[model samples]
Target: MNKLILSAAALALMAGAATADTVRMGTEGAYPPYNFIDDDGEVAGFEREVGDELCARAELTCEWVTNEWDTIIPNLVSGNYDTIIAGMSITDERDEVIDFTQNYYPPTASAYATLTEGADMMGGVIAAQTSTIQAGYVAETGATLVEFATLDDTIAAVKNGEVDGVFADKDALVPFVEEQGFMFAGDDVPLGGGIGLGVRESDTELKDKFNAAIDSMKADGSLNALLVKYFGDETAQY
Candidate 1:
C-alpha cells in the first residue's frame, strides 16, 4: 500500500513537470556539424545534442524549429520561436536585438577556399553567404563580394568560376575541399566572439535557466565532449 502511494505521487510529479515549460529551439538546419536535418528528417548535430542536453539539465521541455539564416533573428524577435540554438555568434549588434546565453561553442576561424592556388584574395571576386560574418569580412578585403542565399550556392559559385573563392567557416569547408579539389587559400581569418544561444530580451528567466544548464555542461565536461565530437580538439578548447 505504501509503495502504491509513492508510485502515484511520482506519476503526478512527472505530469506536472511535463506541463511546466517548453522552449522552442530554432536553428538553421542547413548548417552542417552545427545543426542539420539528418537523413531521418530529424534535427541532428552538435547544437542539437548540446541543446537537448541543456534542456534535460534545466528540467525544461523543448522542441526544435528550422528557419532560414537571413531572417532568423527577425523571426525570433517576432516570437516564431523561444530560443535560437543555431550557430549564431554573440556580437554587440546582435546583443542589442536579443540577449545571449554564455557561449557554447568557442570562436572558430573563417577561411577562404579556391580551386586555384595563389588565387587573388585581394581584388578577386569572392562568394559569401548573405548576412554572415564571413560576408562582412570579405567585403572589407577589397575583393568584390558576391552574396549567395545559401552556403552551397557560395561553393557552387567557386566551382563554376563565378567567383574566385568562397569564404566560410573553416570546419564547414573541410568536406568541400576534400571532395571538390578546392584548397584553403590565404590565412584563416578569425571572426565572431563565439557561438551562443539567442533568447528574447524579455526572457531573462529562460536565459538564466539555459545559462545554468550551460554551466553544468561545462563543469561536467559534456560540452567539451560534444564540441570535440563534431569539431576537432582545437575548437573544443573552452
Candidate 2:
C-alpha cells in the first residue's frame, strides 16, 4: 500500500459511489489513543468521543467506520465514507484532494522507535504506515523505507527484526515505549500542521459544520479537556 498502489485504488474507488446522511466517519482503529477498538469490540478512543460530540453539536447523525490507513483517503474520495477523523494532519498535499475541518489536535512530532539502542533512523531500514507523513519523511531520508498498512505492522517489523526502527507520531508510539520496552531512537521529526477531520472536495457544507463544531469545542475549552484526557497535559499547548 505505497503511494503508487494507493493512487490506482483511489481512482477505482472514486468511480464507485457516495453516501447520504448518516455521516460515515472513517478512521484507522489500529493507532491507539487517537483511535482504536476497545475490548468491547466497539470503536473507542479519543477521536471517537470527539467525533461523536462534533456530530452531536452539528446535529448530524454519524456512524464510525474503520478502514485501513493506506486506503483511507482513497475510500473517502470513492464515497466509501463521508469524513476521515483519523489522526491525519492538515497538509497542503492532502488538501489538494480533500477539505479539512479546523484542527482538533495540535501540531505533533514524529519519532522513531526501536527495540535496541544506537539505531540509525536516518539511513537504516525504517518502517512507516503507508501514505502517511512519516512514510513520506522516511522516503526523503536516506533510509530504506518499508511501508505497512497499519501502525501495528510497522512496529511488528521492528520487533520481528524486519526493520531497524519504526517511524510514527511520537504520542502514538509513547505507550509502546512505556509498556513494551521499546526505546526511543533518533530525534523527533516535526511533521504535520495539526490533526483535522478530512472530507471530500465537493462537501464544503459538511466541512463547515465540522469546523463550527471544532470551533465551539475550542472556544468552550472542551477540546483542551479532551487533549489532556487522551494525550496528557504536557502535550502541545494548541
Candidate 3:
C-alpha cells in the first residue's frame, strides 16, 4: 500500500513539473519598433512588449531569443523555439506547416520610391523580401519583382535606382521612407496575410493559451495601446 502511494505521488510530481510552462519566444531583432535590440542589449519593441504581456497573461515564463527572419518558422518546427512573436504574417501557406495564434497586429504593404523629380515615372518594378507575402503579391500583380535579403537592402535598391519602388510592411516602411527622404506612392496595397503569433503544430495547448491571452489583450485595449505607442494612431487596427 505504501508503494502504491509513493508511486502516485511521484507521478503527481512529474505531472506538475511537466506543466511548469516555459514559452521560448523567437523574433527578428533587426526590425525596429517591432522587435529590436536596445542600447542595453535587451530586446525592446512593440512585439517584445506584446509578447511579454501575453506570457504574463498566460502564466508562463518567457525567454526572448533573436533568430534570423528566414529561419524563425523552421526553428520553431525543429524545437529550437516554442513560440514566434515576430511580426509574422498568417498565410494559408504557412498554416500548412505551423499553427498561429489570434492576430495581435495587422500590417499592410506599400510601395516607396526615391525622392526624385521623376520618381513618379519610376513605377514598374516592385521590390520585396524574398519568400514573403509581399513578394508573392508583387508576383501576382505582374510587377517586375526585385527580391532582397533584408528590408534595408530593398530600400537601398530603390534609393539607388536599381528598383522602381520597394514594397514592405507599412509600419516599417513609413518610418524608413520618412527618415531616408523617400516618397511613398499612394498604392495602399493590401498584403496577403495578417500578423499573428506562431507555434508548432503539436503545441495546441500553448497556441490556445496564446490566443486567449491575445483576445484578452485586444478586449482590454492593451494591443491597440501598444500599436499606437509604437506605430501611431494611423497604424492601429485593433
Best by lDDT: 2
Instruction: Give the Cα RMSD of candidate 1.
Output: 6.0
What C-alpha lDDT values do all the predictions have?
0.90, 0.90, 0.81
> Which ranking of candidates, highest lDDT first?
2, 1, 3
Candidate 1: regions farther than 4 A off: 1-20
lDDT by residue for model 1 (1-238), tens = 9999999999999997786588899999988878889999999998999999999999887799999999999999999999998888888889999999989988888899999998998789999999888888888889999999888899889889999999999988987888779999888988888899999999999999999999999998988888888887767466
Choose 2 or 3, whichever is better by TM-score: 2
lDDT of 1: 0.90
Candidate 3 positional error at 122, Å: 8.5
Model 2 C-alpha lDDT versus the unseen true structure: 0.90
> How many residue pairs clash (N, CA or C atoms closer than 3 angstroms) in each of the candidate models, in the order given?
0, 0, 0
Candidate 2 regions with alpha-carbon error over 4 angstroms: 1-21
TM-score of each: 0.89, 0.89, 0.86
Better of 1 and 3 by lDDT: 1
Q: Give candidate 3's error at residue 147 in angstroms.
A: 1.8
Q: Which residue pairs clash within candidate 1?
A: none
